[model samples]
Target: MKFIISVDCEGPACVVGNAGKALSASRDYNFACREATLEANAAARALFDSGAREVWIWDSHGQGLNLCIDQLDKRCKLILGKGFTCRFPGLDNSFSGVVMIGYHAMEGTKNAILAHTYSSESYKNIRVNGQTVGEIALDGAVAGEFDVPVIFVSSDDKGCREALTFMPWLETVVTKQGMGRNCALSKHPHMVQEEIYSGVLKAVNCIHQTKPLKFKSPVQLEIDFKAVSQAVKALVYRRRGWRLVGPRTITKKIESMREWIC
Candidate 1:
């Protein structure tokens, strides 16, 4: 068996907003990266112990270079950099299952720590088939296109709830409880990592029962930009299958999640 672990930097006791903070190595950002790496290491080690032949860890946070590479479990290969057409780069039908760690909820989610769909600055809300979705749903649907199920996830309490709302059978661990966009009551890092290790083992054991998170074909994707200027900028070079539906919104029709473009 083989597995992929997607690690984002905002949920494992992290509250930073953008890539600049991560690049600058601010105290909070550095701590967030270390915590995320520890959690990823735990998940990777769990997958390896559970009979996975290959484990790939993807640093999926802002700038796509958030995790501490050297500190990760050497047993698994790391995926770095970003700007690929596919959300989860190198993801294909060959992987057995997907695991997400240190993820938050969608933009404008009440009391979700550092919540945003894809970009905190650019997007106000992203809806697929008329339901608001976070990275968990969007990325999960992308995996679903390849028949791969997201078996495990770790995030804040609200983020876990969002994941459950999308896929009730997903195994989740809550690393913190959100008090506001930048405030969270976090658990001890050691505790969260331990839970992630065990939760991953359980999730992989029940992988056969979990289903891929797929949306019906010809999906209606609606994106509400944070500002009208952002939407206007998008309309300047409108691509195929995209339309300006409102002053701050753009709509698109896609046959699959893999076709998500705007």
Candidate 2:
């Protein structure tokens, strides 16, 4: 089976703060980056062993280039930088399943390491049909459009909990438990890797049992901006006839939201 992995850094093993420091060239970021690489590599190894013949991975982190390309498994390919959305850049739904590795809880998640919705600076919370969402959920929806199920994911405990609201049957591996964005209880990188390798196998065995996420027609999306000024000045503002539901929140239907997002 073919699977796609969308990897992020904030929720990886040993990741307790924003991935910014994790990707920096400084000594501090050096260790964090190493941890991020190990987590992705481990997850990639698991995907390959679990009957996944072809695994496509997207470095879905800051600058989209945090992964140490040399460390990744030779069998997998990576996607990095802009113009990427099946609806956004262009990853079509042609895989059996998708995996979100190293994701975190949405913005405002207390004790969720480096929790931030979308831009952290732009969004307070994002929801679909009134349910809270994070990157894992949004990307899963993108996969869903093509009937692909997100079978496995790894993140912090809060992220794990938030994920179930979207896919009750999906398997999740929590690599950390946060006390705040900057502090957390991290799992050993090696231990996290072991689980990553195992989770993929388990997911493959039960892939057929779970259904792809299904959203109703006329999908609705609500965005709560972190700043009211951004909501007012955004190019998308008034571009799609979105309604002002709250001071910093905008509610718009798919067609309208599409115009704004796409």
Candidate 3:
């Protein structure tokens, strides 16, 4: 089997804050990235041990360059950088399953560490068919388009719960319990990696039972920006199906998840 591990910087036990801090070149930022690298590599190693033919790691954090590439599992291929034309770039029907590591909750999730949907500075919320969703749901839907199920996920308590709502059969590891957006009671990095390794092994064993996360046809996609200026700037998308539903909100109706996301 083949697998892809979509890794985000926040919600991992080793990271207390969001990837936005990495932009400032902080020491803690590098440390968090290194720890997340170890966790991701752990998952990759587990997949390889579980008879995986291939494993790809996507640095799905800010700027898509946060992971410590030198430390990643040597057998795994890395997908880095940004400016992709679509969501989950390079992902296709060829892959078997997706593993989300260090994911977070949506913008308004209570007691969720570093919580935001896509962007902390811009988006207020993102909804699919009137239901608010975070990266967990959005990414899962994108993988679903390829018939790939998100088999495993590791995050803070709220984040793991959020993943469960979308994929109840999923194997999850909670790295922390969120006290607030920037505060969490986290497990040790070693413990988090151990759980991630074991969780991936279990997920692989039950891959046949898990189902891809799919939404009904004709999806309604909505974006609520944090500022009116952001919405004004996004008005250019109006020609591409976006409509100004409010001063800081845009809505679009599409025939499939692929239309809005792919």
For residue 62, model 1's alpha carbon misses the true position, in angstroms, by 1.2
In model 1, the worst 10-residue window by lDDT is 15-24
Clashing pairs in 2: 83-89, 84-89, 85-88, 85-89, 85-90
Error of 3 at 257 (Å): 2.1
Q: Give candidate 2 regions above 4 Å deviation.
A: 18-28, 85-89, 235-238, 255-262
Which ranges in model 3 have alpha carbons more than 4 Å from their true place? 18-27
Model 3: per-residue Cα lDDT over 136-204, one tens digit each: 999999889899999999999999999999889999999999998767788999999999999999999
State residue 40's C-alpha deviation in candidate 2, in Å: 1.7
Model 1 reaches what TM-score against the true structure? Answer: 0.94
Error of 3 at 3 (Å): 0.7
What are the runs in model 1 whose C-alpha is more than 4 Å off?
Answer: 14-26
Provide backbone clash counts, one per model.
Answer: 0, 5, 0
Q: Whole-model lDDT for model 2 versus the true structure?
A: 0.75
Score each candidate by Cα lDDT. 0.86, 0.75, 0.86
**Model 2 quality (TM-score):** 0.88
Compared with the true structure, what per-residue lDDT tens digits does model 1 show for residues 1-262? 9899998888885454443343225557777888889999999999998999999999888777878888987889888986776788889999999999999888888988878787767899889999988899999999999999999989999999999999999999999999877677888889888999999999999998899999988899998998999998877766676799999999988888987642
Per-residue error (Å), model 1, residue 191: 0.6
Q: Please provide, for model 2 over 115-193, each residue's C-alpha lDDT reduced to its tens digit, 9 standing for 90 to 100.
A: 8876766888788877777777777776777788889888999999888888998988989888777788888889988
